[model samples]
Target: MQSIHFISGLPRSGSTLLAALLRQNPRFHAAMSSALAPLVSANLDIMSSGQEVSLLMEESQRPAMLRALFDTFCRTTTEREVFIDTNRSWCAKMPLIADLFPDARVIACVRDVPWVLDSLERLFRKNPYENTRLFGNDGERATVYSRMESLARHNRLVGYPWTALKEAFYGEQADRLLVVDYEILTKAPEKTLRLVYDFIGEPWYEGHDFDNVEYDAPRFDEALGIQGLHRVRPKVAFEPRRTILPPDLFKKYEHMDFWRDTAGSRANVLATKRATREDTTTA
Candidate 1:
């Protein structure tokens, strides 16, 4: 790929949909999360460990080695001019990416913390017959409260990327980050995509068909016992449904939306007006 960018942020946010839309541009190759980030971390750990062979790792070669990993992992996409790698860990690895791809931009797809929990809760409730891989033991999947708590732990699916996103948003490379609100994207996708194109400095792709968008990962979702986890509707209209969380639980995280309070904000946001505020409260 000639150019490399990143897509990352909260779970249940619009990263998957963004990828589905972006790949419409033949010059771009975008997809679900890849093993590249963890692979990079593992290699670095091995090289820096006290093992005798660790001495062979030259400091001068670290950048080349790390970069080659991307080159090799993305070798199949050579025909595509841009590769928008989607990995939540990329937000945590901003410093490394800064050193590797100076011109790269990271688009963070985000939603209010409570709404994020609510969406996950809806998925958990949708498959009551199958215990999800999202939580380990039966105890963790016992109720909406249990499931939400499990998913919000520091190392869990929702929290890790959320924490890493906050890190990138406040780090020295904050200028490289652009925060996209999920509500705004669903409310006004075309305008949102226009801003995204401008942020990544790509030519405006005016061929998007919002009503015909399609993306799904049945195998991936099925493996996790969540049939629609990565599913995107064929059309892109925002669905207005009451949330499924308990009232107290929903209110607990309502104020956790740090991205909304831009008192000293450095990241770009598209959340001036929330799209479906009237339907935000969960039933």
Candidate 2:
């Protein structure tokens, strides 16, 4: 039986890094988050086509729609032993999708909460899709970012729905379900990759080259286009090392240790006061 690995976690939790590393292995076929684009678009299309999809429909049935939508993916990968899909937020709907994969492994990629929010804020201005999809209009984007309370609430709400599944799945079959911390993964890529390979029952081969494993490089610009295929853009080469929050705003979120350790820590806080100091020393 073919197996599916559901790579999930909060957004900006290093799911991309984990997914990229997994894709380096020849036996693994990493689908990235694009696996669900068709299903999401199809659902929207159906609703737009005047077919009423009940919000109360049982979760089991949702997977049926996805099964039909992802049939092409399943067909194309008949030769592969494992098919992977890395969508951190998809954990919220795992019950609906897990039905399609009886022989699947679920991997949760997590990061410190504060770090997650810090990373999210960087994308706030550029992320137009969330404004339209979650909120009614793009005008409210500024409002959402301006209010500290609303931003925190939004972040919590965004990730809360997936917590229960993470608890239960990891609690019951700890080995089958993996939780990889973003910090550890990035700091020690080869070690983490070995653990992931072992979990999937794949042999570790020495002299394997991982330095130039191509990920979502081609889809970067395509992601900028709102229309067309709607491919989820992967990480790019350059990104801002830290987000600069206002003093008042920093004070509000300072209690989050993960954020403090990386961005708001004593060293970081002090460094900000001293201009020309090395801000990139550690985070």
Candidate 3:
């Protein structure tokens, strides 16, 4: 692969769906949560001062090895010209990515915070008999309020990526990021996708098809006890529904979409904050 980009942002914010669409381009390789991050992270650990072997490793080789992970992962796996690795951890590792892939950009897939929580809760309830591994135990999943509290903690799924996205959006390297919202991705796919191509300096693919899409990770989801968690629908369209969250909890996070308040954002946003949903058909 010639260039490696990233797909990151809040959980349940359509990163997998973005990857599904990107993979439609013959020259692009995109997937849900590639192994590159974990590989690079492990290498970073043993190469750091935390490991005595660090004394024998040269500082120059660190970037080389880390960058190799992306290249090797792509080259060995696919012949595609570009690779868009998906991982929420990438948002927290912006400095490392910039140093390694100087010209690369990170595409942050985001959604309204309340909807993010709703998506997770929906998945949990979908599999009524199985408890999702998203929480530590039963008590954590005891109620929608508890689930929301756990998910919104600083280190958990939704909160960590949200925080990391904020850091990247406001940090010195903010210009390396592009914020694309779930609403736009699902409701206005072609337009949103073309914007992504422009953002990454890729020529737009004209033959893109929004419907007849396919993406699923049954094994991955089953392992997490959250079947269909990473699945994308065959048709790309938004299905608006009433908030399952209790009124107060939903109200608390409905306005916490930090990406919307772009006053000081050096990053470019490709979406409006939550729009007034309508019943019109996107197809």
Q: For each candidate, give its TM-score against the true structure.
A: 0.94, 0.60, 0.95
The residue-by-residue lDDT of candidate 2 on 46-98, one tens digit each, is 64434566454664666576666566665575456666776644555444454
At residue 206, candidate 1 shows an lDDT of 70
Q: Distance from true position, residue 260, model 2, in Å?
A: 16
Report the lDDT tens digits of candidate 3 across residue range 1-283. Answer: 4788999998787888889899999999999997888888888999999798799889898888777777788899888899888999898899998998888999998888877887788888889999888999988989998999999998998889989998999988899999998878888899999999999999999878898788999999999998888888888997767777787888788667778878987899977746442221211
By TM-score, who's the top model here?
3
lDDT of 1: 0.82
Q: By lDDT, is 1 or 3 better?
A: 3
Ranking by lDDT: 3, 1, 2
- Total clashes, candidate 3? 0
Q: What TM-score would candidate 2 get against the native?
A: 0.60
